[model samples]
Target: MHWVFLVLAGLAEVAFAFCLGKARLATGSESVGWYAAFAGCAALSFYLLNLSLAHIPLGTAYAVWTGIGAVGTAGLGVLAFGDPLTGPRLFFLATLIGSVLGLKAVSA
Candidate 1:
Protein backbone atom coordinates (compact mmCIF):
# COMPACT_ATOMS: atom_id res chain seq x y z
CA MET A 1 0.00 0.00 0.00
CA HIS A 2 2.74 2.39 0.93
CA TRP A 3 4.67 1.34 -2.17
CA VAL A 4 1.59 2.16 -4.20
CA PHE A 5 1.52 5.60 -2.68
CA LEU A 6 5.18 6.02 -3.49
CA VAL A 7 4.64 5.00 -7.09
CA LEU A 8 1.71 7.37 -7.42
CA ALA A 9 3.77 10.14 -5.93
CA GLY A 10 6.48 9.46 -8.47
CA LEU A 11 3.94 9.54 -11.29
CA ALA A 12 2.59 12.78 -9.95
CA GLU A 13 6.09 14.14 -10.04
CA VAL A 14 6.25 13.15 -13.71
CA ALA A 15 2.89 14.84 -14.30
CA PHE A 16 4.11 18.04 -12.78
CA ALA A 17 7.16 17.96 -15.01
CA PHE A 18 4.92 17.45 -18.01
CA CYS A 19 2.77 20.35 -16.93
CA LEU A 20 5.81 22.53 -16.66
CA GLY A 21 6.90 21.65 -20.16
CA LYS A 22 3.43 22.30 -21.52
CA ALA A 23 3.18 25.54 -19.64
CA ARG A 24 6.39 26.69 -21.24
CA LEU A 25 4.99 26.01 -24.70
CA ALA A 26 1.53 27.38 -23.97
CA THR A 27 0.29 30.94 -24.13
CA GLY A 28 -2.05 33.17 -22.12
CA SER A 29 -4.91 31.26 -20.47
CA GLU A 30 -3.60 27.95 -21.67
CA SER A 31 -0.37 28.53 -19.83
CA VAL A 32 -2.30 29.32 -16.69
CA GLY A 33 -4.16 26.05 -16.95
CA TRP A 34 -0.95 24.11 -17.34
CA TYR A 35 0.56 25.89 -14.35
CA ALA A 36 -2.51 25.07 -12.32
CA ALA A 37 -2.14 21.46 -13.26
CA PHE A 38 1.49 21.68 -12.24
CA ALA A 39 0.49 22.98 -8.83
CA GLY A 40 -2.06 20.25 -8.31
CA CYS A 41 0.33 17.50 -9.32
CA ALA A 42 3.09 18.95 -7.19
CA ALA A 43 0.82 19.00 -4.17
CA LEU A 44 -0.36 15.47 -4.74
CA SER A 45 3.19 14.25 -5.22
CA PHE A 46 4.38 15.78 -1.98
CA TYR A 47 1.38 14.54 -0.05
CA LEU A 48 1.88 11.02 -1.31
CA LEU A 49 5.56 11.19 -0.55
CA ASN A 50 4.79 12.19 3.01
CA LEU A 51 2.36 9.35 3.37
CA SER A 52 4.83 6.83 1.99
CA LEU A 53 7.48 8.08 4.37
CA ALA A 54 5.41 6.63 7.20
CA HIS A 55 6.45 3.17 6.02
CA ILE A 56 9.41 3.48 3.66
CA PRO A 57 12.89 4.46 4.63
CA LEU A 58 13.56 8.12 3.98
CA GLY A 59 16.59 7.69 1.73
CA THR A 60 15.12 4.82 -0.22
CA ALA A 61 11.81 6.56 -0.73
CA TYR A 62 13.40 9.78 -1.89
CA ALA A 63 15.74 8.04 -4.32
CA VAL A 64 12.95 6.01 -5.84
CA TRP A 65 10.70 9.01 -6.12
CA THR A 66 13.33 11.08 -7.88
CA GLY A 67 14.38 8.13 -10.00
CA ILE A 68 10.86 7.65 -11.25
CA GLY A 69 10.48 11.34 -11.86
CA ALA A 70 13.73 11.58 -13.77
CA VAL A 71 13.07 8.53 -15.90
CA GLY A 72 9.46 9.32 -16.64
CA THR A 73 10.11 12.96 -17.37
CA ALA A 74 13.00 12.11 -19.66
CA GLY A 75 10.86 9.64 -21.56
CA LEU A 76 8.10 12.20 -21.92
CA GLY A 77 10.57 14.75 -23.12
CA VAL A 78 11.84 12.46 -25.79
CA LEU A 79 8.40 11.37 -26.90
CA ALA A 80 6.45 14.62 -26.59
CA PHE A 81 8.97 17.42 -26.62
CA GLY A 82 11.53 16.26 -29.18
CA ASP A 83 14.37 15.63 -26.80
CA PRO A 84 17.08 13.30 -28.02
CA LEU A 85 17.62 9.85 -26.52
CA THR A 86 21.26 9.22 -27.28
CA GLY A 87 23.28 6.16 -26.37
CA PRO A 88 24.87 7.74 -23.29
CA ARG A 89 21.50 8.95 -22.09
CA LEU A 90 20.00 5.50 -22.54
CA PHE A 91 22.88 3.86 -20.72
CA PHE A 92 22.64 6.23 -17.79
CA LEU A 93 18.91 5.80 -17.61
CA ALA A 94 19.32 2.06 -17.38
CA THR A 95 21.88 2.52 -14.62
CA LEU A 96 19.54 4.78 -12.69
CA ILE A 97 16.74 2.26 -12.99
CA GLY A 98 19.02 -0.49 -11.76
CA SER A 99 20.03 1.61 -8.78
CA VAL A 100 16.43 2.31 -7.90
CA LEU A 101 15.55 -1.36 -8.10
CA GLY A 102 18.63 -2.25 -6.08
CA LEU A 103 17.52 0.10 -3.35
CA LYS A 104 14.08 -1.44 -3.27
CA ALA A 105 15.52 -4.93 -3.20
CA VAL A 106 17.77 -4.09 -0.25
CA SER A 107 15.13 -2.23 1.74
CA ALA A 108 12.23 -3.63 3.81
Candidate 2:
Protein backbone atom coordinates (compact mmCIF):
# COMPACT_ATOMS: atom_id res chain seq x y z
CA MET A 1 0.00 0.00 0.00
CA HIS A 2 2.78 2.35 0.87
CA TRP A 3 4.60 1.37 -2.27
CA VAL A 4 1.50 2.15 -4.26
CA PHE A 5 1.25 5.52 -2.62
CA LEU A 6 4.89 6.17 -3.38
CA VAL A 7 4.46 5.29 -7.04
CA LEU A 8 1.37 7.45 -7.30
CA ALA A 9 3.21 10.32 -5.72
CA GLY A 10 6.00 9.91 -8.20
CA LEU A 11 3.53 9.93 -11.07
CA ALA A 12 1.96 13.06 -9.66
CA GLU A 13 5.36 14.64 -9.64
CA VAL A 14 5.69 13.81 -13.32
CA ALA A 15 2.26 15.28 -13.96
CA PHE A 16 3.25 18.52 -12.30
CA ALA A 17 6.34 18.73 -14.41
CA PHE A 18 4.31 18.13 -17.55
CA CYS A 19 1.86 20.80 -16.48
CA LEU A 20 4.67 23.28 -16.03
CA GLY A 21 6.00 22.51 -19.46
CA LYS A 22 2.61 22.94 -21.03
CA ALA A 23 2.07 26.15 -19.14
CA ARG A 24 5.25 27.48 -20.63
CA LEU A 25 3.94 26.83 -24.13
CA ALA A 26 0.48 28.22 -23.46
CA THR A 27 -1.05 31.68 -23.31
CA GLY A 28 -3.58 33.57 -21.17
CA SER A 29 -6.32 31.34 -19.77
CA GLU A 30 -4.70 28.17 -21.09
CA SER A 31 -1.50 28.91 -19.23
CA VAL A 32 -3.48 29.69 -16.12
CA GLY A 33 -5.24 26.36 -16.41
CA TRP A 34 -1.96 24.54 -16.74
CA TYR A 35 -0.60 26.34 -13.74
CA ALA A 36 -3.66 25.34 -11.74
CA ALA A 37 -3.09 21.76 -12.81
CA PHE A 38 0.50 22.02 -11.71
CA ALA A 39 -0.57 23.23 -8.28
CA GLY A 40 -3.06 20.42 -7.89
CA CYS A 41 -0.58 17.78 -8.90
CA ALA A 42 2.08 19.20 -6.63
CA ALA A 43 -0.29 19.13 -3.69
CA LEU A 44 -1.36 15.59 -4.44
CA SER A 45 2.20 14.46 -4.86
CA PHE A 46 3.26 15.88 -1.55
CA TYR A 47 0.26 14.47 0.26
CA LEU A 48 0.88 11.00 -1.15
CA LEU A 49 4.54 11.24 -0.36
CA ASN A 50 3.74 12.14 3.22
CA LEU A 51 1.42 9.19 3.45
CA SER A 52 4.06 6.81 2.08
CA LEU A 53 6.62 8.15 4.51
CA ALA A 54 4.75 6.33 7.24
CA HIS A 55 6.21 3.05 5.92
CA ILE A 56 9.07 4.00 3.60
CA PRO A 57 12.39 5.43 4.66
CA LEU A 58 12.75 9.11 3.85
CA GLY A 59 15.92 8.79 1.76
CA THR A 60 14.63 5.82 -0.22
CA ALA A 61 11.22 7.30 -0.83
CA TYR A 62 12.62 10.64 -1.90
CA ALA A 63 15.13 9.08 -4.26
CA VAL A 64 12.58 6.80 -5.85
CA TRP A 65 10.03 9.57 -6.16
CA THR A 66 12.43 11.96 -7.79
CA GLY A 67 13.80 9.16 -9.94
CA ILE A 68 10.38 8.41 -11.34
CA GLY A 69 9.68 12.08 -11.88
CA ALA A 70 12.98 12.73 -13.62
CA VAL A 71 12.81 9.76 -15.94
CA GLY A 72 9.13 10.24 -16.72
CA THR A 73 9.45 13.99 -17.31
CA ALA A 74 12.47 13.52 -19.53
CA GLY A 75 10.69 10.88 -21.57
CA LEU A 76 7.66 13.11 -21.95
CA GLY A 77 9.84 16.03 -22.94
CA VAL A 78 11.39 13.97 -25.68
CA LEU A 79 8.06 12.67 -26.94
CA ALA A 80 5.96 15.80 -26.59
CA PHE A 81 8.23 18.81 -26.52
CA GLY A 82 10.96 17.85 -28.97
CA ASP A 83 13.63 17.57 -26.31
CA PRO A 84 16.79 15.72 -27.34
CA LEU A 85 17.13 12.10 -26.26
CA THR A 86 20.83 11.67 -26.54
CA GLY A 87 22.80 8.55 -25.72
CA PRO A 88 24.33 9.94 -22.57
CA ARG A 89 20.97 11.06 -21.25
CA LEU A 90 19.50 7.63 -21.94
CA PHE A 91 22.43 5.97 -20.22
CA PHE A 92 22.02 8.10 -17.13
CA LEU A 93 18.29 7.52 -16.94
CA ALA A 94 18.87 3.80 -17.07
CA THR A 95 21.40 4.10 -14.32
CA LEU A 96 18.99 6.15 -12.23
CA ILE A 97 16.32 3.49 -12.72
CA GLY A 98 18.72 0.82 -11.57
CA SER A 99 19.61 2.82 -8.50
CA VAL A 100 15.97 3.38 -7.64
CA LEU A 101 15.26 -0.33 -7.99
CA GLY A 102 18.27 -1.14 -5.90
CA LEU A 103 17.02 1.14 -3.15
CA LYS A 104 13.61 -0.47 -3.23
CA ALA A 105 15.14 -3.93 -3.03
CA VAL A 106 17.34 -3.10 -0.08
CA SER A 107 14.66 -1.16 1.74
CA ALA A 108 12.14 -3.93 1.32
Candidate 3:
Protein backbone atom coordinates (compact mmCIF):
# COMPACT_ATOMS: atom_id res chain seq x y z
CA MET A 1 0.00 0.00 0.00
CA HIS A 2 2.30 2.71 1.22
CA TRP A 3 5.24 0.95 -0.38
CA VAL A 4 3.37 0.86 -3.64
CA PHE A 5 2.77 4.57 -3.51
CA LEU A 6 6.43 5.17 -2.71
CA VAL A 7 7.52 3.06 -5.66
CA LEU A 8 5.11 4.85 -7.98
CA ALA A 9 6.35 8.17 -6.70
CA GLY A 10 9.88 7.15 -7.47
CA LEU A 11 8.87 6.09 -10.97
CA ALA A 12 7.16 9.42 -11.46
CA GLU A 13 10.33 11.11 -10.38
CA VAL A 14 12.16 9.19 -13.10
CA ALA A 15 9.53 10.27 -15.62
CA PHE A 16 9.95 13.86 -14.55
CA ALA A 17 13.70 13.67 -14.94
CA PHE A 18 13.41 12.08 -18.37
CA CYS A 19 10.89 14.67 -19.51
CA LEU A 20 13.14 17.45 -18.28
CA GLY A 21 16.02 16.11 -20.36
CA LYS A 22 13.81 15.73 -23.38
CA ALA A 23 12.42 19.21 -22.96
CA ARG A 24 15.87 20.66 -22.79
CA LEU A 25 16.91 18.87 -25.96
CA ALA A 26 13.70 19.49 -27.88
CA THR A 27 12.87 22.33 -30.20
CA GLY A 28 9.73 24.45 -30.79
CA SER A 29 6.39 22.76 -30.06
CA GLU A 30 8.01 19.53 -28.96
CA SER A 31 9.68 21.31 -26.10
CA VAL A 32 6.30 22.60 -24.90
CA GLY A 33 4.89 19.08 -24.65
CA TRP A 34 7.95 17.81 -22.90
CA TYR A 35 7.77 20.64 -20.39
CA ALA A 36 4.09 19.92 -19.80
CA ALA A 37 4.77 16.25 -19.20
CA PHE A 38 7.62 17.14 -16.87
CA ALA A 39 5.32 19.33 -14.82
CA GLY A 40 2.65 16.65 -14.61
CA CYS A 41 5.08 13.94 -13.60
CA ALA A 42 6.72 16.19 -11.04
CA ALA A 43 3.36 16.96 -9.48
CA LEU A 44 2.32 13.31 -9.42
CA SER A 45 5.62 12.29 -7.92
CA PHE A 46 5.33 14.82 -5.12
CA TYR A 47 1.73 13.94 -4.42
CA LEU A 48 2.46 10.22 -4.12
CA LEU A 49 5.53 10.89 -2.04
CA ASN A 50 3.46 12.97 0.34
CA LEU A 51 0.94 10.19 0.62
CA SER A 52 3.62 7.67 1.46
CA LEU A 53 5.12 9.97 4.04
CA ALA A 54 1.94 9.67 6.06
CA HIS A 55 2.93 6.07 6.78
CA ILE A 56 6.70 5.94 6.45
CA PRO A 57 9.37 7.81 8.32
CA LEU A 58 10.55 10.93 6.50
CA GLY A 59 14.23 10.08 6.24
CA THR A 60 13.74 6.46 5.24
CA ALA A 61 11.01 7.18 2.71
CA TYR A 62 12.83 10.09 1.14
CA ALA A 63 16.08 8.19 0.80
CA VAL A 64 14.41 5.20 -0.81
CA TRP A 65 12.31 7.37 -3.12
CA THR A 66 15.30 9.32 -4.36
CA GLY A 67 17.38 6.19 -4.62
CA ILE A 68 14.84 4.46 -6.82
CA GLY A 69 14.49 7.50 -9.02
CA ALA A 70 18.22 7.99 -9.36
CA VAL A 71 18.83 4.40 -10.36
CA GLY A 72 15.85 4.24 -12.69
CA THR A 73 16.70 7.50 -14.42
CA ALA A 74 20.30 6.59 -14.91
CA GLY A 75 19.37 3.23 -16.34
CA LEU A 76 16.89 4.85 -18.72
CA GLY A 77 19.44 7.41 -19.82
CA VAL A 78 21.86 4.64 -20.66
CA LEU A 79 19.33 2.58 -22.58
CA ALA A 80 17.37 5.34 -24.31
CA PHE A 81 19.72 8.30 -24.66
CA GLY A 82 23.04 6.47 -25.08
CA ASP A 83 24.38 7.79 -21.80
CA PRO A 84 27.57 6.10 -20.67
CA LEU A 85 27.46 3.43 -17.98
CA THR A 86 31.04 3.28 -16.98
CA GLY A 87 32.39 0.95 -14.32
CA PRO A 88 32.72 3.55 -11.62
CA ARG A 89 29.25 4.91 -12.32
CA LEU A 90 27.71 1.47 -12.06
CA PHE A 91 29.60 0.76 -8.87
CA PHE A 92 28.42 3.94 -7.25
CA LEU A 93 24.86 3.32 -8.37
CA ALA A 94 24.99 -0.15 -6.85
CA THR A 95 26.35 1.32 -3.67
CA LEU A 96 23.49 3.78 -3.53
CA ILE A 97 21.00 0.95 -4.05
CA GLY A 98 22.62 -1.07 -1.31
CA SER A 99 22.42 1.86 1.04
CA VAL A 100 18.76 2.28 0.25
CA LEU A 101 18.09 -1.39 0.92
CA GLY A 102 19.99 -1.18 4.16
CA LEU A 103 17.86 1.74 5.25
CA LYS A 104 14.70 -0.15 4.42
CA ALA A 105 15.85 -3.23 6.32
CA VAL A 106 16.67 -1.19 9.41
CA SER A 107 13.40 0.78 9.29
CA ALA A 108 10.17 -0.42 10.85
Candidate 4:
Protein backbone atom coordinates (compact mmCIF):
# COMPACT_ATOMS: atom_id res chain seq x y z
CA MET A 1 0.00 0.00 0.00
CA HIS A 2 1.09 3.59 -0.57
CA TRP A 3 0.35 4.47 3.02
CA VAL A 4 2.62 1.70 4.24
CA PHE A 5 5.38 2.83 1.93
CA LEU A 6 4.86 6.39 3.05
CA VAL A 7 5.20 5.41 6.67
CA LEU A 8 8.31 3.42 5.85
CA ALA A 9 9.70 6.44 4.10
CA GLY A 10 9.07 8.53 7.18
CA LEU A 11 10.79 5.98 9.38
CA ALA A 12 13.65 5.81 6.95
CA GLU A 13 13.93 9.58 7.08
CA VAL A 14 14.31 9.37 10.83
CA ALA A 15 16.88 6.63 10.47
CA PHE A 16 18.81 8.69 7.97
CA ALA A 17 18.74 11.71 10.23
CA PHE A 18 19.98 9.72 13.17
CA CYS A 19 22.69 7.94 11.25
CA LEU A 20 23.92 11.16 9.72
CA GLY A 21 24.11 12.67 13.17
CA LYS A 22 26.10 9.73 14.46
CA ALA A 23 28.37 9.80 11.47
CA ARG A 24 29.22 13.34 12.29
CA LEU A 25 30.11 12.24 15.80
CA ALA A 26 32.33 9.25 15.13
CA THR A 27 35.89 8.80 13.90
CA GLY A 28 37.03 7.41 10.50
CA SER A 29 36.13 3.72 10.36
CA GLU A 30 33.00 3.74 12.47
CA SER A 31 31.61 6.76 10.70
CA VAL A 32 31.74 4.96 7.36
CA GLY A 33 28.97 2.56 8.34
CA TRP A 34 26.87 5.41 9.64
CA TYR A 35 27.29 7.34 6.44
CA ALA A 36 26.38 4.29 4.40
CA ALA A 37 23.23 3.72 6.42
CA PHE A 38 22.30 7.34 6.05
CA ALA A 39 22.76 7.22 2.29
CA GLY A 40 20.71 4.04 1.93
CA CYS A 41 17.85 5.37 3.99
CA ALA A 42 17.96 8.68 2.21
CA ALA A 43 17.61 6.91 -1.12
CA LEU A 44 14.68 4.82 0.05
CA SER A 45 12.96 7.83 1.57
CA PHE A 46 13.30 9.83 -1.63
CA TYR A 47 12.13 6.96 -3.80
CA LEU A 48 9.01 6.27 -1.76
CA LEU A 49 8.25 9.95 -1.54
CA ASN A 50 8.44 10.26 -5.30
CA LEU A 51 6.18 7.24 -5.74
CA SER A 52 3.66 8.51 -3.18
CA LEU A 53 3.57 11.89 -4.89
CA ALA A 54 2.23 10.25 -8.07
CA HIS A 55 -1.01 9.36 -6.26
CA ILE A 56 -1.00 11.71 -3.29
CA PRO A 57 -0.77 15.46 -3.31
CA LEU A 58 2.79 16.65 -2.81
CA GLY A 59 1.89 19.03 -0.01
CA THR A 60 -0.04 16.39 1.89
CA ALA A 61 2.57 13.65 1.52
CA TYR A 62 5.45 15.96 2.34
CA ALA A 63 3.67 17.34 5.40
CA VAL A 64 2.73 13.88 6.62
CA TRP A 65 6.22 12.49 6.10
CA THR A 66 8.11 15.32 7.80
CA GLY A 67 5.63 15.68 10.64
CA ILE A 68 5.75 11.99 11.44
CA GLY A 69 9.54 12.05 11.11
CA ALA A 70 9.75 14.92 13.61
CA VAL A 71 7.58 13.14 16.15
CA GLY A 72 9.43 9.88 15.72
CA THR A 73 12.84 11.54 16.02
CA ALA A 74 11.81 13.38 19.18
CA GLY A 75 10.55 10.10 20.59
CA LEU A 76 13.90 8.51 19.83
CA GLY A 77 15.65 11.39 21.50
CA VAL A 78 13.59 10.85 24.62
CA LEU A 79 13.65 7.06 24.75
CA ALA A 80 17.06 6.28 23.28
CA PHE A 81 19.08 9.36 24.15
CA GLY A 82 17.51 10.52 27.42
CA ASP A 83 16.51 13.91 26.08
CA PRO A 84 14.52 16.05 28.50
CA LEU A 85 10.79 16.45 28.03
CA THR A 86 10.25 19.99 29.16
CA GLY A 87 6.95 21.80 28.94
CA PRO A 88 7.99 23.58 25.80
CA ARG A 89 8.94 20.29 24.23
CA LEU A 90 5.57 18.83 25.10
CA PHE A 91 3.83 21.91 23.77
CA PHE A 92 5.67 21.69 20.46
CA LEU A 93 4.94 17.99 20.24
CA ALA A 94 1.24 18.66 20.77
CA THR A 95 1.33 21.37 18.15
CA LEU A 96 2.97 19.04 15.69
CA ILE A 97 0.32 16.40 16.29
CA GLY A 98 -2.42 18.96 15.94
CA SER A 99 -0.99 20.18 12.66
CA VAL A 100 -0.84 16.64 11.34
CA LEU A 101 -4.47 16.09 12.27
CA GLY A 102 -5.50 19.39 10.68
CA LEU A 103 -3.61 18.48 7.51
CA LYS A 104 -5.29 15.11 7.43
CA ALA A 105 -8.68 16.75 7.67
CA VAL A 106 -7.92 19.24 4.93
CA SER A 107 -6.45 16.60 2.68
CA ALA A 108 -9.45 14.34 3.23
Candidates in order have lDDT scores of: 0.98, 0.97, 0.95, 0.86
Q: Per model, how many backbone clashes are there?
A: 0, 0, 0, 0
Which pairs clash (backbone N, Cα, C closer than 3 Å) in model 2?
none
Query: After superposing candidate 2, which stretches have Cα over 4 Å from the reference?
Result: none
Give the CA lDDT, 0 to 100, for residue 21 in model 1: 100
- RMSD of every candidate to native, in Å, equals 0.4, 0.5, 0.8, 1.5
Highest-lDDT candidate: 1
TM-score per candidate:
0.99, 0.98, 0.96, 0.88
Best by TM-score: 1
Query: Where does model 3 exceed 4 Å of error?
Result: none
Measured with C-alpha atoms, the lDDT of residue 33 in candidate 3 is: 100
Candidate 2 vs candidate 3, lDDT winner: 2
**On residues 27-81, what C-alpha lDDT tens digit does candidate 1 reach at each position?**
9999999999999999999999999999899999999999999999999999999
Residue 42, candidate 1: alpha-carbon lDDT: 100
